[model samples]
Target chain A: MAVQVTQAGADTKTGVSGWSLSIAPRRGALSVVEVIVLAACIAAALTMTNRHGVDIMIRTFLWAGLALAWNIAGGYVGLISFGHAAFFGIGAYTSTILLLSYGISPGIGLFGGALLAAAAGALLTVVCARLRGPFFILSTLAAGEVTRIAALNWRSLTGGAEGLEIPAISSATDMVFATQWPYVGLVLSYMLLVFALSVWIERSRYGYYLFATRDNEDGASAIGINPGVMRVSAMALSAALTAIGGTLFVQYFLYLDPTHIISPDISFEFALICAIGGLGTASGPVFGALIIVPASELLRGWLSQSASGLYLVLYGLVVILVILYFPSGISGAIARGWAALTKKKTS
Target chain B: MGGADKKEDQLMLWVEGVSRQFNALWAVRDVSFSIEAGEIVGIIGPNGAGKSTLFNLIAAAIRPTSGDIRFLDHTITRAKPYQVSRLGLARTFQIPKPFRQLSVRENVMLSALRRHRTPHRANRLAGETMEFVGIDHLADTSVASLTVGLLKKLEVARALATEPSLLLLDEVMAGLTPPEVREMMAAIAALPSRGVTVLWVEHVMMAIMNVAQRLLVLHRGQLITQGKPAEVSKDPAVIAAYLGEKYAARS
Candidate 1:
């Protein structure tokens, strides 16, 4: 319940003496900690020389961005969609197809992919508007599976199971980079953009409406907030952002395989990261990505030849523990710890 | 009813033969009533009297089976809840439904957002609304920490934040202590002065009788009696169905 007025100069119109923005402040140390973590991420991306290490950094940033995007629907709006991979696949395939078939630059193609994914998201939300809780979740999973099957069989459009590859010619317009640093930079920018958008949504009037709908739909509708419109818009916005992340992923990997792109595992990973970091908070998914991605990558790298799926078992265990013990995730734990510390000091 | 001639003097709410059935049973049947602007109207009934169902029908939370409901000049019988709410009508639940995760101020701000469209302006109005409802001191506190009485006040604060011309209050003083009930009565009594026409559904006879300008009594999903509180209290049908004979003798 700690309310922070948006930074002193952020708005001149917030003239109420005691009223707060209701956006919980990071308190004293959490803000500093976040800044340090962000700085370390940038430093690792720019200064790391090892190709393996840089690859992990790139994945971390990309997944973080994707998780933040998913957090809009899953965390803020309580949609809990497991079908987000459809949007991601749509984005990746759209951009890749535009480039391979139409000779379009991925830079411009990304927008087309995002738009299509957003429409799909909106459609999914509208179709499943009446479904709540587990039913809604199952519908999203079914949608993802349907998208995967369609991509696998539709040989004319999606290139079928053979997948598509952007030739590694290293063109700037095509988003094929010679070095890994640019991709890292690109994804870091994407993460920052999603993070900024999440914060804005959390503070805006629309954000309040969205939160109200999630917390109590009947109460919200009783006060003129349309839950249907809120859910649809949140899902669409989340899908569009996630699609952008997908496009970036394809651009960096230079490959798009239906099995991999639209995999339920990828969708689960996005939700898992958000759950690990903090679902609704803007910075939760960022922290989840930064921590979980590198840890998983290093674990996989170590256990690759000796025990291939051992890392997966360990990853699942950690996720289970975090979910069971820290239901609110890492950011929530930090906020709680911060509150306890301040209370002790005052008393 | 020369309704077109006195457009400015139109009723705040008009319910005509509205009925709602669930499964095999009728929750409300053939109910009709109208409230003029700036009047405090009370609806009282025993358990299962369809008072809450009536509120839900008017608020468009549920559709009526066979009748039309008008708020101001708009037909809201088939309207969505948000549409009805947007057209100067707001209703509170019988059991308080505060956003459990939000602060009291934030809960009010959700309703305030409907009018202000900016969190900054909404926050200002929400603050005033909370103060008006005497819960400003609990603004930043979580709704989870509130008592039943405070939760009810928070509900009122939230509804008031919407700046509704007509407010539907459902059992605002149900679980309150005597002093808390008095405080709530005072707060609700002040609402009509601000140009809000209230349709209050309550089991608390003392509070409703003291405050409401008129009373509508329901029995078995039908309006059994409608008149001033003193007259309704003395009605033979109302006395036999609801208030016991001893209460009738006392009144």
Candidate 2:
């Protein structure tokens, strides 16, 4: 027999009174705004003729991709790593070495770089599985420093403090191009690939696991979701993606060194871009890169002759003020505003 | 009483000589008990009586200083919380531990993922569980906006979504209104018919007495007595240790 039981909150069926709880509305795959943004980015990359402008766009797209990669670990899994530059350096070195020594195309070598970086990421996660919060963050920072030092000292393959410069050979197969247009397309493709992946991941069941683990470890574990496994997998995936971004950076610049590629500033740049845009949402990093990269580059270009390093101070102030005033970042503010607008229009 | 003679598989849970020590204090000490399938056992003790510690030990959230816990003949003394949870044992936190970033439906869906591998099926299961617990209306609402009673109900709904054979409930009725308590009791009392054996640690006397088939009175990390609710309620030792003479006389 079915036992008929009355609900305790039958009167609350109308819903909780007077509390607008939607801070950030959940976004599905390829929202209208996202599509518009993607179209705009593609148009700008394709139509822009000025070499300087194209350079900025390429950097913008690359940073956007890198920030999205960091969000997998830092935003989704709450693994705020300050050592992603290590993975970036590894990827740049891997592809460059393979190309310089064995005559392998960077097209194939990028995958090899991604694989090695993923292995390193998995190892770091396992080793620091027991740590949390600041300890975990510090461990990543130290790991980045250690990788940088190792690269700096081991001058044999990495070319020491100088750097490895990819030869200027305009070959499509080798991923080296004479004109900036090809690179504009190449980097834009990379950005779109990461964007598509982020959209897929944000909608999948695995995304739910990542969200749960981030919010509460004990609660997630109670439901049979292993936090350790989730963290490791997320770190590995994030690292592999970051490494791919690094390889693209090397190809674009055609040069890399331990000091520049594995610098803490590079790691912080990826994280800060995510922070400025929004951390977890797929579109946050894109917005962040669009807003930050152009502003920084334009400020430096316009103000460099007049004021030496005023751009750095101004850039620092903007980042600080954004973080202080809008803790959820720009993407979160937009989401909340949109939610409020829709609700007002309906009600 | 004769649970020891029964086959290990017949028992839903067997806790043997379990003890947990933190510094100088023994939170739980050498406690042994067995609950047969389809049993509803309530563990009652005063504050700091090691009830939660015992629950934690059984669930493998914390390791026992010494002892063994078995779920249907499988040793889970050293198992991780997720491993124990995967073995058909689900538990609730003493305090509601909802995933704050997720909606109410998503919180339940996380546990539903244990039985249903896909998020779509898990979402359906979550909806059913929510309806059963009377929180279907709050499906898309943020967990931060929920009342204490609603949060507790969400916890139960999440645990139930896992389709466990054994369920551990820790202080689920602590802050509920009288009517809310009655509703929760009715829901819990119906679990046996669904093949779930409940090990509940509760402080609410009147509610537990009416619902539990058996009661285990604990005092300062030791099992003072275990018997039918009526017999255990009347035990003088239990009256002195936990219930006090005033409540005992009234009962």
Candidate 3:
């Protein structure tokens, strides 16, 4: 068992001294690889984002941000909530409702929505505090169902589940813009914002508490780490970010419905991207979104006339293979490969 | 009782009438004990003797079926686990659970940072703790590559990093070579000078007998014997339950 670890995995400079994964705190130092990845993200956003692929690009970036948010609770804190769409719905409805009802700008509504979603996240965390494993997952799913049902029934607030369409009067104050690049720019900024936050968390003393809590809740608690508070805060933080994505999503689509916004599938998609790219690392969600969004979109575009479910079938097949074989996802595989390469270079 | 519970010089940990039931079986029944500020106490029993469960009850990992537990004047039977920790209590698992991906230092730093906010201070504390446990050189090594002896050292370091007033060690000397066990025994013996109180649960009789100032023997969830190692070893009930009569005579 010990021999396998030395032979296989390491992050940086795995020679005589030993190997350490770059994803570690490293006292918050940015490695050469991290800088390049961030620069590439910026460069891709600037040049490749155009009129045609903008929708896919925008969605991908937004989903990336959302996934990073979800990773805090799902990966780091180990809550494994399957009902994050409720938070997404809260963001969408908060912004859209305020905009439509009181003429409040989506700008202020964004904060309002995020705060509300965070509160909801805190509530769910408290409710699920005693639950573990599948029970906790089910509690979250049930919470989503409750949110969806409530939204559907609350006609005056949510338009009786038929959804509300944003008025076509586009203005700068309304968060409305002319082109898809601006939207791309908006989502790209969110992606970077979430990525930075993830980095901050990884480096923070609090992040250590989170990591310790997840791996050994018993050990952590015995040493003065509060699992309950950590779980609650992680949920709130994750929900706030996901809510921001929801606000952006509604702004882009100009429409909202209870079903699509609060669906279990939306929640699954957010978590799946992180799971696919890498569950715990900050970069995982970005890689996951970058790959999953484009592949699915291009496939859908190409296979549109062929069959309705064909593209999704192929997409599902790819996800299954990644999950089955590379359980750590794309980002982890890259780290291991990098370690191996460095080891080979030295030898 | 409450006044004594709050006395600064009385005892570091006080457990009164603590019992834990799972389904129908009484895993731990009517167990009660107290330890002072700087004493090394050992808890020994056969398998399924509820030693780990008692540790869990003390740490608030699981609530007791009934009874009160006090640490540092705080009622911890219903307290959160981290809350128990914040009062300066730490423990180790019988089965060592090192975070596989993290470096050994990172594992220790997780506990060290409880009181030290900055990474520099935490790292320094982790280094000192590792050295104290005699694994400072392996600080940067991944936990995945550690040998069982080194893993036990890391576990000790991890708990010690918290700078707890009271430390509970579960089977630290289990499955170790005789030399490795001796080295760990030296570390355990030295903890009292650093202002630590210990409740060590061990199956390795010789190691505990050498290091512990006092021993508490448990059988079927009840503490069967309590005294110095020599006296407890000679008790007929202790011998009947654990050490056979011939081994008892030999001792």
Candidate with the greatest DockQ versus the true structure? 1
- What digit string (tens of lDDT, one per residue) describes model 1 on residues A1-347? 34322221111111133333322333111255566677888888778999888888899999999999999999888899899999999999999999999999989999999999999999999999899999999999999999999999999998899999889998999999898878988999998888878877877778777778887899888898889999999999999998998899999988888999999999998999999998777778988998899999999989999999999999999999998877777876776666668779999
Fnat for each predicted structure, in order: 0.55, 0.50, 0.44
Report every candidate's CA lDDT. 0.85, 0.86, 0.83
User: Between the candidate structures 1 and 3, which one is better when assessed by TM-score?
Assistant: 1
Candidate 2 A-chain TM? 0.91
lDDT of 1 by residue, B1-251 (tens): 33555854568998999999999999999999899999999999888999889988988988999998988778888999999889989888877877766677788887988778877778889889988888999887777678888888898989998999999999999878899899899989999899888999998999999999999998889998899999987788887777666766665
TM-score (chain B only), all candidates: 0.94, 0.93, 0.93
Q: What's each prediction's TM-score? A: 0.93, 0.93, 0.89
Model 2 spans > 4 angstroms off: A1-25, B1-7, B243-251
Candidate 2 lDDT tens digits, A1-347? 22223221111111111122233433434555667788999999878998899999999999999999998999888999999999999999999999999989999999999999999999999999999999999999999999999999988999989989999888887799889888888788888998888866766668778978998899999989999899999999999999999989999889999999999999999999989888877888999999999999999999989997999999999999988776667776776677768789999
After the best TM-score superposition of candidate 1, give how far the Cα of residue B132 lies from its true spot, in angstroms.
2.0
Off by over 4 Å in 1: A1-30, B1-3, B243-251
Order by DockQ, highest first = 1, 2, 3
TM-score of 1: 0.93
